[model samples]
Target chain A: MGNPAFDILSILPFAVACSFGMLILLLEVFQRQTASRSYLAGIAVVGFLLTAFVSGSFLPTGTARATFGGMAWIDGYTQIFTSLFCLAGALTAMIAPRYLQEHGADRGEFYALLLFSVAGMIMMVAAADLVVFFVALEIMSIAVYALAAYTRRSKLSSEAGFKYFVLGAFASAILLYGIALVYGATGTTNLAAIGQAFGGDVARGATGDAAAMSTLAQNAIVAAARGADVSVAAVIGNTGAGAVPLAILGATLILIAFSFKIAAVPFHMWAPDAYTGAPTPVVGFMAAAVKAAGVAALFRVVSVALFSDSFRGGEYGWVQIFFALALLSMVVGNLVALVQGNIKRMLAYSSVAHAGYMLVAFTAVGFRGGDISMGSGLVFYLFAYTIATIGAFGVLSWLGSRGMPCDNFEDLDGVGYRYPWIGLAMSIFMLSAAGIPPAAGFIGKFLVFKSAVAASAAGGPGSGLLIFLVVTGILVSVAGVYYYLRVIVHLYMKKATREVPEMPYGAARWAIVICAVLTLALGVLPGKLVNSSEQAVGQMAGRADGVYQQSAEAPLPTPGGIRLIR
Target chain B: MAETIFFIVFALGALGFSAAVLIAKNPINSAVMLVCSFFCLAGIYVMLSATFMAVIQILVYAGAIMVLFIFVLMLLNIRDDEIEAPRLSIHQGIAILAGTGIFFTIALSIAAWSGSSSRVAHDTMSDTFGTVEPIGDQLITSYVLPFEMAAILLLVGIVGAVVVAKKRF
Candidate 1:
């Protein structure tokens, strides 16, 4: 307990960022006696970049280890997601000071809140215990709730904040209830313990119809058996209870909560309003980082915790649900976006469609009979998605003045001529978002779709659906190009009428350029990213040996943690 | 036996107060009842053996938060008088619909799959409920953030109360 983060010192970068954020707050508060707050801003940026590099080093080969007495865990999956979070945080922090200072809302707390949120997200991915997970989620959420309404006088910002908070609370409540039920079913709040519960089913021949589960189940039972139980039969009964429908309900409720985060269809009511109403820089943060974390968490929880033939009692039915969600999201998001006049709203819908593409990667992750593959592809896709989205939002933010808000198609009428680099970077972002080649988004979609095609050839339960997914992926992408190009059409195709009010060429320009470069870099060299993903998939599947295992960071109280056994 | 009684009482109290809060038209009354609801929740904590949390609930939520609320009401002293009416605004409608959708989805979905076998047979008395010592030990060691939130909450409470209490300082 001396250093709670010591067990997973690999995640020290996240902690350091959090500390840097606090220091930024303190530095700004006392900077009246010293030089400019810009110095502190530079320090924050440098700290984050160093942290980003350190985390990136971990990405070459995913290392799965637990830290802080099993409270926080850093494995291959956590490594990839944490890297994504850090990069997004770094990008947002880079531009935030100048952008916020331009409008007079430039407080040190803004950076602190952003850093804290990133810290929250990092812990979220690494959380081995329910308490830690929930706390991490809250820390991230509360910060953003304020950020969404940062523009106090703007009625839209206020309304957006209200809508997001209320809906977010409701979803959080549902998620908590799900956690309670999962704890009830498994008796252990520890993920490692929960995974082992699946092994228990394999013990009593509860493998249902999936013979492929035998190996995972055997390994899980062996791993779970290593941990002493206060009540053996209770543990077995809970394991046996996996055959019950409550497990599915728990998984579904959790899914519903995550779907909201990813802005997936049906649960995506909050995203457009929140995105459109928020200030542009905050919108960039939401579109890129918040949404990425949501999807990453969904990937971690659904794949690692639920989604098994034995656990769900032969109901590995998310293949169709994901298929439908992907199709519906692509169709609905792209279609609605085509008619949208607001540029930010259009990008929000584009973000939704991007979620669909990622879902395709997730769908391809598990084989029909249940072997997993192309996990690294999903990570690469996320990395691409994060870079491109943040880049798009940054351009939009720069174009938007405090009064104008840069939302409508007309806002960018002559923006391309005024800010040529921004125009090109935004075009690249739009192209990448549309899945055009030579950008990260293109390669990401390619790997995801290729894996889906492979998954289909393997003759999973829904080859027909995978085929459908593949077709819609192409068709939906065509729709995506239309909306993305509409902005391009406004930018270069149309001529500027009024003088484009230009700010000093400083931080925003640099951020957009860096984002554009990263997008291109990721597009060209995605091997390391994919390898990270591969390691992550192993850790996620590694827990399949036993659902949840206790590590140093988060140790489960024998009776308190696992209620299914009680 | 004790736990069963505690569960029954706490469950009833939680449901009843929540319902009252929902139905009550008076904003002031609603706020007061909400405080009561929090107290009842603190009672449930005693049953769960989280004594420190029980004290925290009554002192912070029931005592401090409620008084601050009352003070604001008196300070404003709206001419509209003792009974504050509730509005069925769009937010309320959205809230109701959302709550209903979630409740139906969860309740009906679980109901459909509830196999007729009730496998819930355990000796509640025999189970050694986690004592405050362990809870404290765990909170300090593993849950330091949430524990630190006590200070944040106090800070927020003081700041928020002051901000609201003084129109402009």
Candidate 2:
């Protein structure tokens, strides 16, 4: 391995974000009590821009290198998601200052906590080991817990924070138990090493060469035959039968934990209250960056560590689990969202529905030979959802004032006539969320469904299921149109029943305009981003194969009874 | 034979104390029973040859945490009559049934696996295994990333505690 000092370069984005976080906290200490703290958001935005720049610099090379002794990976997948999270964080910072001030809860620690949370998201997406992933997840989660309760004067905010903390801690405990079980089964926490012990190379060879025993397995057996190792046999043999149940159970638990983070159905009981009670800008960050981080973690753990021929199909497969979750989330989220009068709560349920749509792409990834396109589709869809959802929440925060919070559908009456720019931005976001044409969400849905159809055409065991899921998603999204349009109807047609005071626009207006424009731009011309997303997934898959090849070439048994290449 | 006897004693003590911790009416008695449970768990850790873990379990949980818990209990000085005894509801019944089902399922699975060839035999463990030195080395070396990240987590936790608990900023 190279010098450990060089590994710091791989985490430069995270370091930059953390340093800015600390700087903001320090600045908060020296500032006069009455002095405006708005510059903290400016500093936080600049920090995010620098982080995005550092992450984007890695995009051209798309090099897949494991750093931090294989505890983290520097690759296109990590770089892309890191930049996306930076964008989301910057937008949230831009939207936050005025909203916080309006509520008389303006504090410098808000920006610091936001920066720290973004730093955690960066580390989490790049994490290659379970330990790194878990720690980074806590770093993200704890900061968010504090941010949710940032406006401590409100009992609703305090209650939201308490509920999120309790549930999140429970989820973390379950996740840790899963990691422990997986380590017990595979003898290592390193994802690549776990892949090796899970007989991924053997399963891959079985698919290619049609061999009863893969050549790699033969090589391992031959090495054992020469008395080089006995544990190699135990590793290969046990994975074939004995440890499979434990491994599957662990994988299932991990999936459940991530589902909680992503707010999938059955595990989404906390989303509505948490979303509605938290500060609007913070909700934007949570809906966009936090959920994207969860999806990124799922992509790594499920696609790299647990991906095997056996794990992809059959009764206990993760694919089936995701299918059930996707179906339930889409139906329940959309149906529940229809009746909600509170715009924030509606968006919360809609976000759950969006999670279902992403899980559709996720389920497609598990099918044989569907990884690349489906993976790209999932990435693109997340970007689309992030921008639109953040924009929606930004507008909500923009409309709200100290005593008069604009949360209900009725609050938007005559808004289109009153503030044309905000009304237009809201319309664009609503259309995108509803997946109307000429908006980013439409293109995102098209890409995901098209990829699913293409995968089905490629003819796999679950081809029929894929087509059925696509059809179901399309039909359910039609119901989503009514609620989305209702916002526009209220915006344009209804008269203001009360004297809604006009609020001055600030940095939040810029964030909304940017999100609206980007949504349209991406929808109209998606070729460049689609290509880059495809390339990123290709590089990710290449890294997985490279790890498998490395393990295949050297089956050397370490004292831990597993071969780990650091 | 001696190891098995110790194992049985420690496991049974842990289970009994845990049950007592749950069932005890007085908050002080429950906290004390929780300490006893922690001590028994530490004993089991010692039997598993995780001496460092055993020591920390006793030192941290029994010594520090239990002391805090007892202090809180005493400070509160809550009367027994003031606290309503929790009546078993449908939710509680369902929770109990599900918990028992899961416990038995896991216990049975472990029993089956222990008798099977798939169970990894850890007879070849190095003498340095579970010791403080190697774990400390690992914390600085291969696990340095997580170790550093945990510092950030704790920082966030401290900040979170202040943000949530502080009366005024």
Candidate 3:
């Protein structure tokens, strides 16, 4: 009983990652005298790094348990998300001081809000129950909404924050409705309990499903068609091993909400406007931390809980819809980025494209064969994406110095010649993002291709998907090469119209430098990082007897929810 | 009979107060009305056997957070004229149509469609079914960490809010 709630701890890293900011805030608000801002920044960075180290330490132990009457699950999947959230937060915190002091917008509360937001993110990732999840989502979102509009003077920033809040609320409402449907269908809010309920329905088969009682849960109708209790011959609909179709619907709604948060295509309208409009450091956090949580949690919710039962009879719209979105994101993200004159908007599109690439791997999750390798590929891609995105934003922040908002491609003109170190770092970041070798991005994409190919090689029909992904992969990367290079072109070829931004010798630049170095390190040591991710993925999909249940039983959408009254 | 009466009063109260939020066209009035609507929601929560939820609805939301929102509105000194600031015709119309359509559709759909429900026929609160004690039990044990974490998060949020909103910090 060391605390089944340790899953709660698994998600704690993100919050802990932001504690330094809070400490700074406490002094600013309560002490009447605040610590030196630089000192506070140092504390924040150190604290975040420490949190990262601690959370990373939790990865190897594959312990799973139900906490407090099954309200939350602390498991390997939770651990993965916690690690990703903390890593993003720590990196952002490390960079914020320079980012803050530069714009004259960085205040003590900025750091505090950042920490509070991170804490909310941690709780959200670990929320096992729907209510808890909704609460946590709000906690995380409101903090971000504020951060998005942190600069009071910037009309664009305020507008971006307002728009994000409005749309985000709309998305949350959809998600809540979906959650309501799920509760009506299953009569439970706990994910594990939902599984049990579905499992029972499946065990009882078609008769139990159609004949069951519980007017409050009309769609749990699978219950009513038979006798009030059970009969031996009620095994028809249980043809599959699980209640998947309904599960799929619930998962899809979750996907839409998560997609909104992460900024995937079709679902990505808010991102470019938001990113271009928000103050820059907030962009860094949103791009890195918000997207990381979305992808990580998506992988967990879909791949772990639902995958146990779903993926059969082609009902989940799994292969086709995801493939389309992924393809669209990849092609559209790159294409749009190319046309964008605003560097921030360009980066926003690049994120969309990167999300597309990640979605491409996620398609593997929906592909008939539940190949564990694809999970690893997705994780690798995430790590690579995180580093590159952060670095890219860092350089952008550097470009926009002393109340200067970096608005257009022209803003970057002549920076390569003027600020060589920072320019070179940005080049590395852009190249890595474009999947060039000797950069983390290339290794990540390579791993994904290899994994998809490996699964196809194993005599499964993943070959069709493999081919489609490979072709798109090559095509999108080629399409992507130009936009990234365009920045470099602006940096080197164009004349410096403004005074060469005296190489921003600050914490933010150092942060960008560190991330660039790590990108290379990951490229060089792809094996080590890949192995860790592979192991984490293995732990995540948890060996339910080593056999990848060739066909899983899934629940279809109930067509309706619980009939609350008889 | 009591359940029916309670449901009517609370539901009507919620609807009425929420309507006040919308019809007033003033952000401050809307926020205060929202607080009243929240109280109605808490009443509904009580009827649902979610006693603690009702308390939290009132305490965290109506009691604490709404104050922050109103304070911000007052501090910003946003005038009545500024409240309905200029909007792009296309964008503003899109927002209005979308919002109206959604609210109307949801109300219509719920009215037309009778969804499934779980019957908690047993009416009395015992050791379970949402008393302060049960919620307390669950919070400390199952939701213990999240409960604690929520407090800490709120604390951080308070500090952050002061920092961001306060001129000096």
Q: By TM-score, who's the top model here?
A: 2
DockQ of each: 0.24, 0.45, 0.16
Which segments of candidate 2 are over 4 A away from where they belong?
Answer: A1-6, A58-60, A200-240, A369-372, A497-505, A541-566, B71-77, B118-123
lDDT of 2 by residue, A85-204 (tens): 899999999999889888877778898899899999988888878888999999999999899988888888888888888999999998998887677655567776565545453243
The best-first sequence of candidates by TM-score reads 2, 1, 3
* Model 2 lDDT per residue over B86-161, tens place: 8999999999998898677656544543444244446644566567876676677657788988888888888788
Overall lDDT per candidate, in order of appearance: 0.68, 0.79, 0.66
Per-residue alpha-carbon lDDT of model 3 for A9-106, expressed as tens digits? 54546556556655766665544343346556666666666665666585446655444334444555566666666666666766666656665565
Runs of candidate 3 exceeding 4 Å displacement: A1-21, A29-36, A58-87, A122-136, A196-250, A311-314, A318-321, A369-372, A450-470, A498-505, A541-566, B1-47, B51-118, B123-128
lDDT of 3 at A232: 10
Model 1 lDDT tens row, A256-301: 7888878888778898999998767888888888887877766666
**TM-score for each prediction?**
0.84, 0.92, 0.79
Q: What is the lDDT of residue B3 in candidate 3?
A: 96
Q: Among the candidates, what TM-score does chain A have in each?
A: 0.88, 0.90, 0.83
Which parts of model 1 are misplaced by more than 4 Å? A1-10, A33-36, A54-62, A202-243, A312-316, A366-370, A498-505, A539-542, A545-566, B1-13, B39-61, B64-128, B141-169
lDDT at A204 for candidate 3? 31
- The number of the candidate with the highest lDDT is 2
Best by DockQ: 2
Candidates' interface RMSDs, in order? 5.6, 4.3, 8.9
Predicted complex 3: CAPRI docking category: incorrect
